[model samples]
Target: MKRDRDLVARVLAAKRDPRCADDLVRDYLPFIKAETAKFMGRSPQQGRDDELGIAMFAFHEAVLSYDRARGAFLAFASMSMRHRLLDFARRERRHADVISLDERRPDGGEGDERALVETIASERDELDERQMREASRQEIAQFAAELESFGLTFLDVSENCPKQQRTLEACQRVLDCARKNPELLDRLLQTKKLPMAELARGAGVERKTIERHRRYLVAVLLAFTNGFEIIRGHLRRIVPAGGDGR
Candidate 1:
């Protein structure tokens, strides 16, 4: 069952604060690229790949349009991305309503070519769908294990997640502080603990806020610091607004 409340909360939060949506986009860039790469059968260059652009557009569409009715956000996003990719592929292949009578079918027979083409496409879609499902499962499992290293779980993150948009952005600022100073993260990895004072001081967030949301920050910072490509893709860039050092 879809978590309607969570979906609604996200929608409301995003509507009130564009940062929420932007953060989501930042965190999911890797996932988007993965979908595009899977379709293209190669890695896409950021600026050069039209397919990647189509995939991104589709992803943004999913972010805005997703609801409990969509089942799951990422799943919906993948489906949307694939559909856009397919549409682009079809458009590119169309040339002046042209068809080749001499074209050989995949099975080496030519009658009902259009029907066979649709059949082939359906099979490919099923295969791609299965592959993407497995990939999503792996990412979740891996992320869960990573959280375990910090003595944390998804429940902890869910319970500790900042409800207010400002609080959420403040947590993002904490992350921004850590990113500027690599050793703070190093300290975290070495000790399996967050450097609270340093993070709060550097990021200019209140130490109490950092402490209160330490569990959530742990998971987030780990994703940003570690090579959690898919997770990193979802994160939006943060520009801290007048962090207080004193």
Candidate 2:
């Protein structure tokens, strides 16, 4: 179910209210770390507890400057967390002096300093509009190819089921599953709309298998949607306003 507008409004209000800082932190911490993880390649601690600490700080910063009327809360939070993590990565690369390695432990040796230097140097070279252009192209091409592949898979599934009864049965199952799970349904709908065969292949199941489990898959997607809604709402309310909003 969608959250009550009033409740979301109250939560948003609380984030800005000095008294609700702790409450807001408790509510949105998981969301902050999750969003940050999506954008980060890998951290030294990997999935250690410290990631949560970094995410909490990022979320707090986001909350300090969020503007409620512009968009949904969690979407804003996701954007904020991504920027925060990216900024951290950039800062770590720029100033080697700020970092310290544990000299006591044998396994806690310093990170590859030369690799870090090279990475920074490489970033300095193409960190321009050209990089943005290439990234955009790659994102689009990847999306397109995935859709094409899925479409082919769908066609193959349809072809394989020579029996009309079986094909109709499969379609019915898929429909039923989609109705139960909104997330799975959305992915299926997107697949239908884009006709992507590659995504189907990448999913590591034949299009028919997805079709067969469509209803259950839809249910799982719906669950994710429900959980995300609760977390995302809090996140959007916390985006800090300074610097580039993107």
Candidate 3:
């Protein structure tokens, strides 16, 4: 684990220096290939496949954008590669066509094709719903564990969350402060406490307001700093892209 972190730090440093970029890419070529192969269901050819090219570019982007707050660098890089491959497939219309209901039955009988179609659709819906529920459950479990590290629980977050728009905005201000200042987040993680004074001063919000929403602010800050994707996705509607806490 320490080794991976060291390598990620090195790659990030290399990203900032043009002279080291090529070496960084060369060293991590296997990683790029593995990520691509995971998505493609087959080992990607280094120089023969377009997906490899896209993965290489995505890996480069990951090195450039990765931060300590965003969790493991390899996980981020894999996600970046997967998303790029998915987007490329979408643009190229690479998805397989649906099987035709009119095709001859494998049973060598005049099967009820319409019934088969309905059954397939119903099963697909059930499977999709099950997968989504499982994913949500896992995300919540992981989030709860993260919250525990800061002496918090899901119940605490729910009960302490601000209800009024004004208070909520104030909490968002604290979150923005933490997000903008990595040092603040590092301090919070190191001390296992919210930097209320720092956050209030940096966000230009009243100290009293920061104290009142301390729990909520801590939860929100942890979500951003830990790269809680599901939580962040859910908050997208509440938080503005400009980070104004609106």
Q: What is the TM-score of each candidate against the true structure?
A: 0.51, 0.39, 0.64
Better of 2 and 3 by TM-score: 3
Tens digits of per-residue lDDT for model 2, 76-143:
45545544555565565556523542222222356533434334445555553443344344333433
- Name the 10 consecutive residues with the lowest summed lDDT in model 3: 93-102
**CA RMSD per model (angstroms):** 15.5, 15.1, 5.4
Q: In model 3, which regions exceed 4 Å deviation?
A: 1-8, 14-61, 69-94, 98-111, 115-127, 242-246
**lDDT tens per residue, model 1, 1-246:** 246356546755665677887776676789999989977879999999899889988877777765432233565577678767766866665531245534445654665344344455566567557655655565666678768978999999989988999998898888777766766766776578999988888878999999999998888777655444455556544334222210
Question: Can you list the residue pairs that collide in candidate 1?
Answer: 26-233, 26-234, 26-235, 27-233, 27-234, 27-235, 28-233, 28-234, 29-233
Question: For candidate 1, which ten residues in a row score worst on lDDT?
Answer: 237-246
| Model 1 TM | 0.51
Show where candidate 2 strays beyond 4 Å. 1-7, 41-51, 97-120, 123-246
lDDT of 3 by residue, 128-231 (tens): 56544544565577668778877888788788888999887777666776777777776776677888888889888898888777777777776666545656
Error of 1 at 10 (Å): 43
List of clashing residue pairs for candidate 3: none
Candidate 2 local lDDT, residue 230: 33
TM-score sort, best first: 3, 1, 2
